[model samples]
Target chain A: MAEKLLEIKGLKTWFKTDDGVVRAVDGVDLHIDRGETLGVVGESGCGKTVTARSVLKLIDMPPGRFEAGEILWKGRDLIPVPAQEMDKIRAREIAIIFQEPMTSLNPVYTVGDQIAEVLRQHDKLSRKQAIAGAVEMLRLVNIPNPGKRVHDYPHQFSGGMRQRVMIAMAMSCKPQLLIADEPTTALDVTIQAQILELMQEMKDKLGMSIMLITHAMGVVAETCQRVVVMYAGKVVEEAPVEALFGNPRHPYTQGLIRSIPRVDRAAAQKERLEAIPGSVPSLLNPPVGCRFAARCKFAMDVCVKAMPPLKEVGPGHRVACVL
Target chain B: MSEPLLSVRNLKKHFAVSGGVFAREVDRVHAVDGVSFDIGKGETLGLVGESGCGKSTTGRCILRLIEPSSGEVWFQGADVTRLGPDAMRALRRDMQIIFQDPYASLNPRLTVGAIVGEALQIHGLAKSRKALEERVLELLETVGLQADHMGRFPHEFSGGQRQRIGIARALAVDPKLVICDEPVSALDVSIQAQVINLLEDLQEKFGLTYLFIAHDLSVVEHISTRIAVMYLGRVVEIAGSRDLYDTPLHPYSEALLSAVPIPDPTVKRKRIMLQGDVPNPIRPPSGCHFHTRCPIAKPDCSQRSPELVEKRPGHWVACHYRG
Candidate 1:
């Protein structure tokens, strides 16, 4: 078995909102193997982002808190780790990249300066050395004329280029794990391809695990070795990428995969996409039963009576449905 | 084969980016430049491209929502570009648009019934209050929303529900052509399929034609009978959905299609990585707008422009080297 780099067990990251206690990442259990790419797939409000944020303890306190579970970074629970310790672990051992590049990057500073700042923070390099390191990082991400473009501001680069800059910054410290929250969601298809390829190249070169959180199954299929499907702040299904796509036991997983209109003859011939009806339940006042039961075609009396437990069906394939 | 319901000739829309001492037209962003296409009665034409490719601009231009700087828009034997405000108002009854952002499109202050009914009121389609309320309820039900939702505000509903409300409003005018501008793009993946499938069902039931504008190729492929690939304010290729997917004519189209990651893990596709970011629309590449990033571009590709010429019986391409 591959060595576990990061293990998250029964994580319950909830937010005390004005409405009520929002169970954003309610009882989630997942892990990332060393040098493995794991995809966390779900729609909005499914808690994929919350789960990722919980891993880094990035969720703001008072409003947000980890109610339960352990974020095991190499078997060491990071829950009790001090703020200063987390600051060290963040860019040095584990790093994160958000969906929107523009928001994630500081606009006032140059791309090179921002990257060098990260290096200076974690690696503790001199200003001159860090600047040189920033240029080298830019080159790794395939930015043309990196030396000159290093002086350019975030706004100076296009969306794709900005994303590349973001990637360079993320990879600068050479973290063992990278948490990408829909890294390419804000990009075009061509640019997304470039970014995904660059990510793959970076992972290969640096030998790092990636926890890629995205809603698009095409992206999951293309990059992830194993996949976890989330619904209404809970894990609905988990499996190896091929097994999950080939034999999706969970009704919700099946609905998601079937709904995506593939660019091929076989998919085009299908009369219509099998859209999962109804909407995701509000986390603040979530349903008493299975979160997906309302929209599930395979829901039974028992499914609505109680939330089902995750049960193993096949090798490395687990589903949280009664069926 | 017959008189197209809509025919656009050399449509162009430019926005002046002014700065410096005087707010003169320092530079013009060529948003939609020299684009032409024909949509036969009830035919769905998919317009697809990246962020600055002007697919949305082209859709808006068809309805004269964003006035074209230069173009001829012929619909049912009349020139839409030449029509006065009153004439245009009358014509708008036949042309409706579904906006991308559901949250922004629907009036938060207004009730769902009021929002949907406003169109019928504007066009003076409803005979009485009772009739209008009944019709609004019927429209609500048609898009899979309960009649009880009619009295609620836009904020009360989810993104998918709000989108349905938007759809119901668009259908109120009894439009013959609907410009669906990334209607499902804002919704979640599972919800997106619902909207895409809903659009198709509505198209069939109402005999409505659609100019579906989106950046997602797969979603566009599922709905559009014919697809037009765009790049930097120009349509590089147009073909039947299957033809475009199976054997793309233009180098750009081929690259664009290849870039899409197929969902199935077993099917290993050779993704053609596009070299760089989309060039600035303010000062687009001189000849072939795509020449800057195109892998197969030649010297002549920069010196002269390529006309969109018919390559096959029904297929068209704008490339110097393509057959």
Candidate 2:
């Protein structure tokens, strides 16, 4: 078996609001092998982002707390590590590219300066060397005229270019894993494809693993080797990409795949999209048993009474639902 | 054939930008220039483009939410472009809009019942309080929301549910033409499909026409009978959905189509990365606005703008090199 670059076991993150505790990520388990791309998919507020943030300890801790979890990076448990140690792990072993580049980047600094800050802090490079590295990173992401664009502020660049700059900055340290949270959500479809292609190239060249969080199954089908389906802060299904798309086991996964509009199929012949009825359950009072039971068409009595443990149904395929 | 529901001809909205306090009117953002399209009765026409391409402005101009600098807007055979505020207010019953951001578009202070029934009250659709409550419940049910939830505030609902409420509000006035301005862009993928399906069902039941403006190609292809590709506030290509996707004649359209990722992993798509960022809207490129980034730009592209011409049956493309 390939060595696991990142292993997440029984990860549970919660937000303590005045009203109640919101279990954002409850007993989620996933693993990304070295040099592999894992796609994490779910509807909005499904805890896909919370899972990603937990890997980096990026969640704000005032109201948010990491209740219980073990994120193992290269055999090191990131969850129990001290803050000082976790900082080194964050800068060297794992990096993240956020969804909105306009907000992720600082407005006060030039694009180059922002990127250089990352390199200088992590790699301990001189200011001059860091600037050169920033330009080099920009070129790697295929930003043309990087020499001039380096001095431009974030607002000066278009959405696509800003995304490229974000990617450049994230990859500046050549981390072992890159967690991209809906990196293409804010971009046009054309620009989205370009960014995805660029990420694929970077992965191939750098041999870095990726945890891609997106709501678009089309993106997962295209880019991911492995897929995890989350529903209301829990993983309902996990499988290889082909298996998930070809024979989705969980009802939520099946409904999600059936909902996407495809161009290849005849429009009139296509069935009315089968949406998973009802919205994602509230995390503050998430349902017992399967979180998806409320919306699952095939719900049984067992589904509502007790939480289902993720069971291995086939080789590398796991599902957490009482069928 | 019945008269078209909405006809927009030579619609233009340009914004003058001054360089400084003393600077002359140095540039104009040709946000929407000479864009023309018609929405047939009970048909959905999808207007698609990248950000800053003026798809939203076109929708706004037709609704007169933002007055166009110049154009002809003919609704039900009447010239609505020249209408004053009072006339426009009277005409508002025939046209309504559903904005993209559900949370931002909705007034948070109001309850769901008030938000949905506000239009009915303003238009005097219901006289008694009891009559308004009944109508509001009917509207909520039409969009798949429960009547019991009417007393709840906007923040109480999820993004998907909030959008449904927005849709219900738009339908409250019994409008013949609904301008959906990227209504599903802010939604999760599964929720987007649900909303699109709901929109389609509502149109069929109400015999309504929709001018759907979005940046997503696949979603547009699935929902629209006809699709128009816009570039720099100009319509670059327009055709029936199948023809446009199968054999896009315009260079920009071809590039745009090629960028959409096929959900199937076996199908490898050749991605055409357009060079340079979208030019500043304040000083859009002269002549053919897309020439600067267009893959196949002839010398004539710089000298004169191309007019939309029929290359195939029911397919129009604006390109100097459309052979």
Best by DockQ: 1
Per-candidate DockQ versus the true complex? Answer: 0.81, 0.61
List candidate 2 stretches off by more than 4 Å.
A267-270, B22-24
Model 1 agreement with the true structure over B1-323: per-residue lDDT tens digits? 24589999999999999998888879999999999998888889999988989999999988988889999999988999999999999999999999999999988899999999998999899999999999999999998899899899999989998999999999998999899999899989889989988888898899999988998999989998889998888999989888888889898899888988889999898878778778889999999998887788889999999999999978999999887
Model 1 interface RMSD, in angstroms?
A: 1.1
Global fold similarity of model 1 (TM-score)? 0.98
Interface RMSD of each: 1.1, 1.9
Candidate 1 chain A, poorest ten consecutive residues by summed lDDT: A264-273
Instruction: Count steric clashes of candidate 2.
Output: 2
Q: Which candidate is the best by TM-score?
A: 1
Candidate 1 C-alpha error for residue A12, in Å: 0.6
Question: For residues A125-210, could you state the per-residue lDDT of candidate 1 as single tens digits?
Answer: 99999999999999999999999999999989988899999989999889999999999999989889999999999999999999
**A1-323 per-residue lDDT for model 2 (tens digits):** 89998999999999999989999998899999999999999988889999999999898997888888798888888877889988877777799999999999999999999999989878778999999999999999999898888999999988999999999998988888999999998888778988998999999999999999998888888999999999888888999998998888998899888887777666542357676666777888888777888888888898899989998988899998776
